[model samples]
Target: MIDLHLIGIGTGNPDHLTGEARRAITQADLILVPHKPGKSDLADLRTRIIAEVCDDALIALFDMPVRDDTLPYLTRVDAWHDEIARIWAATMAAHPEAQKIALLVWGDPSLYDSTLRIAARLDPAPRLHVVAGITSIQALTAAHAIPLNTLNAPVTISTGRRLRDHGWPDGCETLVVMLDADCTFQSLDGDGFDIWWGAYLGMPEQILEAGRLSDASVRIIARRAEARAAHGWIMDTYLLRRRA
Candidate 1:
């Protein structure tokens, strides 16, 4: 039986690794790193973290499969995850002696990450352990120097697709959006709404923008496009507040 540790590394920053996460990495017998063809920066960051923290731990790199866009969303994701599980099984098989294996996840594994689900598919399913790390929401809020919720008020957390489809949620004045590549905030009415937007939080390449939704919308769209073009990828999150 394998002892699998899913450790959160936080958003592309080695400094964000918690002491618990560091200890787990150093103690791991084998660490698996995923590589995407065009996203070398992501894999590089993980490699650097291991190099800095772990001593003489065995490292295995696996190619991550791209999800098919033609299939229905949920179906595509499920199939992609199954493929990843197969790859992971093969990797683990190669290291017959390794009992403790670790995977470094971006941000928090529990928040908007599917590593846990994928891990469940392993045959004889390894004993699972989770080490929590800083989430993008915390990084975004901290970058803007703003509190997540107003006094005694509720806050709603959602995805870009949900926001675009459902508009703003009811019963909450504050909303935090994630996994939105499309800038779904554009779908909401700008009246009385303020936005705090951040990209690459906790990293040297971080960027921040905030103002009335009406005033910032266009600028944010342009900036996001430019940044994505320059970096070949972008991960961002934003908080929106409706003024009372």
Candidate 2:
């Protein structure tokens, strides 16, 4: 049976890697890296992280297949996952004796990432092990040096799509938004809500802005665009809350 290690490398910072993550990389027989077209920089970032942690492990790199977004939402994702599984199978088949394989996961695997689910589709599924890393939320809060929620209050985490469709979550004073290509804060009716936003958390090019949503919405949107242009990519998350 193939032993697979799904190691979370945290956000984009090399320092976020834990000692356990370091050990996993060193112990792996073959480490797989994904090559994404039009995004060579992202792959480079992954390579840099691996280089810092794994000095001697054999590295295997392969092209990542783009999911056809045209198909029905769930169906498209499912089909894309199947293709990823096939790609992995092909990559591993070349080195059948490589007992320990590792994939560096961005952020925590159990959060919104699908790496774990994709691995499940592999025929004769490999024995999986997860090494948890700091999540984007943790990085965001750490960058800002603010607690995620007010003393003992609850926090609800949701995606941008859900925030736009459902509005603020019920029964929760704090809302943390992620996976937002569109700034969903503008869709809200401008209540007394306040926002603490960060883009590319933990990276040197990180951007942060926080204030009453009414005052900061436009600035955040403009800054996000500017950062994306400068870095060629952006991953942002925001926390919104109102005093009860």
Candidate 3:
């Protein structure tokens, strides 16, 4: 059985990598890197991170499988995940002597990431160890220098799709949204909340905006658009607190 290490490398900044993450990389016999057609930069970022910890690391790069857009979202994602697991299994099978294979996950794998889910599809599931790294929420809160919740109130985390489909979560005063490519907040009657949004949270080109949603929505929408156009892609998260 192979030993699989899913190491979270944090948002965009390499500094967000924890000591455990570094050690996991250094000890990994093979590191799997994914390459997407338009996202060469992401692959490069992972390569750079691996280089920092293990200059001589054995890195195997694989082209990422594209999800079928024609199929329903959930079904498409499921099939796509199956393809990825197959590729990962095939890749590891090639370097059978490697024994310990590591994949650098962005942010904590336990969060909204699908690495853990994909891993479950592997045949004879490998011994999995998760190395936690800074999450976008943590980075967003840190960049804004604000507490995540108000006065011990509970915090709710959801995706942009959920927020857009279901409206605000019931009984949630503070909400954090992730994986939202569209400015779904624009669809909300945002007058009663304050938003703290950040893109590229720990990176040098990071952008942050915070204010009452009524005022900041437009600004964030424009800024996010500009950043995405400039960088070709953007990973961001935001926290919204209902104004009391």
lDDT of 2 by residue, 25-131 (tens): 98899989998887677788888888887777788898989879789878988998899989999999988879999999988999889999999999988999999
Q: Provide the RMSD of all predictions against the true structure, rounded to 1 decimal.
A: 1.0, 1.3, 0.8
Each prediction's TM-score versus the true structure:
0.97, 0.96, 0.98
lDDT agreement of model 2 with the native = 0.89
lDDT of 3 by residue, 36-83 (tens): 988899999899988988899999999999999999989999999999
lDDT of each: 0.93, 0.89, 0.93
lDDT of 3 at 235: 90
**Backbone clash tally for model 3?**
0
User: What does candidate 1 score in Cα RMSD to the true structure?
Assistant: 1.0
Worst lDDT window (10 residues) for model 1?
A: 163-172
For model 2, state the Cα shift of residue 165 in Å: 1.8
Clashes of each: 0, 0, 0
Superposition-based RMSD of candidate 3 using all C-alpha atoms, in angstroms: 0.8
lDDT of 1 by residue, 117-176 (tens): 999999989999999999999999989999999998888988998888878888769999
